[model samples]
Target: MTNVREAALDVIEKINKNQAYSNLLLNETINKHKLIRKDIGLLTEIVYGTIQRQKTLDFYLDDFLTNRKKIQPWVISLLHLSLYQMIYLDRVPDRAVIHEAVEIAKKRGHKGITGMVNGVLRNVQRKGLKDFSSISDSAERVSIEKSHPLWLVKRWIEQFGLAETEAMCEENLQAPYVTARVNTMKTTVEQVLHELSEAGLDVIKGDLSEDAIKVIQGHLIETDVYKSGEVTIQDESSMLVARALDVESGQAILDACAAPGGKTTHIAERLQGEGYVQSLDLHEHKIKLIKKQAERLGLTNVEAMALDSRLVTDKFEENSFDRVLVDAPCTGFGVLRRKPDIKWSKKPEDVERITSVQWGILDSQASLVKPGGKLVYSTCTIEEAENQEIVAAFLKDHPEFSMDNTMIERLPNGVEPYVDGGELQLLPHYFGTDGFYIATLIKDS
Candidate 1:
């Protein structure tokens, strides 16, 4: 348990210093420590919970700490981890939490530091934390309560209204479900669910896409079902991209910014070993990931290459493909449930830089879509500037393309009402899914 707390603190400290993503760092720490299954759950809970509620935890710690500037960053991180378990996790008693924290401080710091750690936690346990509800400013209150940045909270309040922004912020703190896309080329959703159940895992059907399955209990990736390519782990909202492309047999497709190939492979599966899909990424190593998924799923039609999509015109002529997908790079605000570290790592200024990259990718790839063909722009972000504004800017500059309403017909039942003016902005509160945005466009014939 002490080792588990220490492991969680190690991940949190690195994340604070901008060393690595929380998801990656947590996995690395777990494997490095060779933690068992039970400890793995506790470690994950502490790491994610601490990061998810970081701003709120800091608000609580501010009441107890006399001089926060003098405290070491790692020591502050330790407090965050300890306070998280004390406030959020009911299974661990107050005594056990403080004992382990003090033990960690004793090993890592001097005598005075250990005493400080002991005194602060014991005081917090006795006096209890102050209620953040008393905060008068809506954005500040929501930011502190939900553990999101104050800037983000204010931005969202302006876009989504105060009520919806608060709901979305609340939703971000909850853990996301493990969703997988069933490989139709290899099997069906019913078959994968059966296989998962037979393996003693609790599973359910996804609400967004028919191809998705939600694993309620146990590791779906570790099972033979996933390794054998019967399923690929993906978010339900992300699985919507391939369906929006409306692929048919033998249609040429281009997946710009394809990597780690979740959607690229889903598009290939829809083609059913018939159509050719040209998948491109800037990095050679990421292209390898696409190829691996393609090979694993026995997809023969996907041709992945190590080339920047912005330079795509250099290799392919205009109007060369039947459909194109620009899963543009943006500040990933939507999937905060899965990657809470994104909340702290991404700055508001990143929106302008990423939107420029997104527009560049769209501009470079738009000419590749065949006349009368479809092109879909999607992102794992809720920012209007990144999603709807980029599409508006594209349509304003290029008159040949118009919003395609036909794609909405193909979407799953519950999601169409959210589509306004042929674009869908899925907030985290929408369906307990990631905050995503999608807009489908048609090239004028």
Candidate 2:
């Protein structure tokens, strides 16, 4: 049997040393190790759990280590994996974890290092986590509880207030919900639910979108329903982007920045093959992804292209599209549940840089909308600079475009009044969905 703990340690080392994305690195490690189903489950839990709780684990390590010498990355990762099992996996015996840690350490580190790992982990086990609660500094307390970078925690506390920041941080630590958009072209929401139930999977209809269904606790990708392409895994917030566009038969639509084609196919499916949906992204390789999704969904109306959205006016005629969806790129703070590493990877300066690009794309695409047609600007982020602030600025400069509030009613129920000046912001903890922002605007004749 492959050593799941060692595999997890290697993945974690890669994350810290090579700056690899945790999820991508974990998936690659699992494949390389050829882990069985059970091993894969344990390895995934160890790697992600350690990364998610790195701050807390480090805090405990600090208390146990007397020398305060900086340990190597591999040793740090090894201790992280072992400590995670001790605290989180109550079913696993502490002795078992200790033994595995020593064995793994013997292979990777010297005998002295193995002795140190045992001493530190056992000391933590004896002390328990009671002392972590008494940390006085708000930054320290939030870091342990939320398992986020001190810089990010402080920034959120400033932006969202104390209570909301704590809530957002805790929410990010939870496993992301598995949400899928039913291929309305192949089946109805009810029909897909029935099919999933027959296959012995537990699922509930999404409270936010009529076409979205939330998988109860497991992944929907493993199910035959997903493999056959009857549904696509997407967050409820993302599902709303396509719905906000409200494509109609025989109307031409443009999905700028369409990759992995979630909204692009949704637009084509909603148009029912009568209208043409042109999907564009800057990378030529991503165009294949769009085409692959289109083929899977049996959607023929979508035409994938590789083009920069900032040059849309130069590439396509003004007033050519009846509808346009610009899912602009941003810091992606809104969807932290799925991509927890983003909290650590992003910096404050990135917001300004991405917002500038969003502004440019919005300005370029604004002219492409036919008079009286719809333009939907959406992002998987909750920052004001990227959402309302950008849209507000656009509306001020482009007098011909006006906010449309009626679009909120088109969204699924239980989506609270996130509409601020006709912009829909979905918070992660609010609807058990990824945090997202969408705004629909109409060009006046």
Most lDDT-accurate candidate: 1
Candidate 1 accuracy as TM-score: 0.98
lDDT of each: 0.91, 0.84
Enumerate residue pairs that collide in model 1: none
lDDT of 1 by residue, 259-333 (tens): 989999999989888878999999999999999998988889989999988899999999999999999988999
What lDDT tens digits, residue by residue, belong to model 2 across residues 1-445? 2288878888888777766788788788878978888888788778778888887788777777777566777887788888888988898899899889988888988989999999888887788765666888987698787788787778767766788778877888787768889998898899889989888888889877889898886557777888788998888789888778877899999999899799998898899879899999999999999999888888899999999999988889989999999999889888777776677677888888999999998888988999989999999987878988999999999999999877876777666466665678876777777878899999998
Give the clashing residue pairs of candidate 2, or none.
Answer: none
Native-to-model Cα distance after best TM-score fit, residue 322 in candidate 2, in Å: 1.1
